[model samples]
Target: MRARDLVTDFPTVALDTPVHEAARLLAAQRLPGLIVVDERGLPSTILPGTQVLRLAVPSYCQEDPALARVVDEEHADRFLRSLDGRTVREALPRKPRELPVTDPDATMLEIAALMARTHSPLVAVVDHGRLLGAVTLQVLLDQAVGT
Candidate 1:
C-alpha cells in the first residue's frame, strides 16, 4: 500500500494556536500529536501530546514522585492555566527536528521507516508542498497486520 492509501483526516494546528486550545483538541480527538502548520499552511513541526502533558505538570512534580502525590487535580490544572498566553511554537522543543513527511506516492514501508526514525505518531503525506493528510501509527499497524 502507498502512504496516500493509508492517509486519514487528522487535525492540524497553526503555529500561533494557543497551547491550551491545542491540548484540548489533542485530548478531544484522542490524537498522539498534532501537525503544526506554518503561515503558508505547510507542515512545520510535530507537537507530541506528551509534550503538552509535560507542560501541564510542574517540573517539580515530574522530578519527584512524592511532590506529584501532593499535587491535586485542581493544583495540577493550575499549571495548564499558565499556557493561556503561550502559543504552540512556544511549546516546541528547544532542539530543532524535521517534521515527519512522506510523498503521496511513497510506499507504506517508506512511511513506516520515516515514522520510526522520527519517533512520530503520524506522518504527513505531502503532495508538492501541501499536506494532503496523515498516515497514523494505528493505520500503519493495521496495514502491517493485514487488518
Candidate 2:
C-alpha cells in the first residue's frame, strides 16, 4: 500500500500552542503525537507524547528510581503545572530530532523505514509541502499483519 492509502486523521497543534493544552489533547485522544505547524500552517515538527511525559516527570525520579515511588498521581499532576506558561516550541529540544515525512506516493516499506530510522511513532504524508495526514504505527502494524 502507499502512504496516501494509509493516511488517517491526526491531531495538529501550532508552534505557539501552550504545552499543557497540547498535553491534554494528547491524553484526551490517546494520540501517539501531534504535528506541530509553523506560523504559516506548515508542518514543521512532530511532538511525541513521550516528550510531554518526559517534561512532566521529575529529573530526580528518572535519576533515582526510588524517588519515583514517592511521586503519586496528584504530585505528578502538580508537576505538569510548570508547563502553564511554556509553548510547544519551548518544550522541544534545542536540536530536535528530524521529523519523519513521506510523500503520498511512498510505499509502506519506505514509510516504515523512515519511522524506524527516526524513532517516530507517526509519519506525516506531505504533498507539495502541505500535510495531507499521518500514518501511525498502529496503522502500519495493522496493515503489516493484515488486520
List candidate 1 segments past 4 Å from native. Answer: 77-79
Score candidate 1 by TM-score against the native: 0.92
Top candidate by TM-score? 2
Every candidate's lDDT:
0.88, 0.88
Considering summed lDDT, which 10 consecutive residues are worst modelled in model 1?
71-80
- Total clashes, candidate 2? 0
The true-versus-predicted C-alpha distance at residue 76 of model 1, in Å, is 3.1
Q: What is the per-residue lDDT of model 2 for residues 65-93, given as tens digits with 9 covering 90 to 100?
A: 79888778787658878788889988887
TM-score of each: 0.92, 0.93
Deviation (Å) of 69 in candidate 1: 0.9
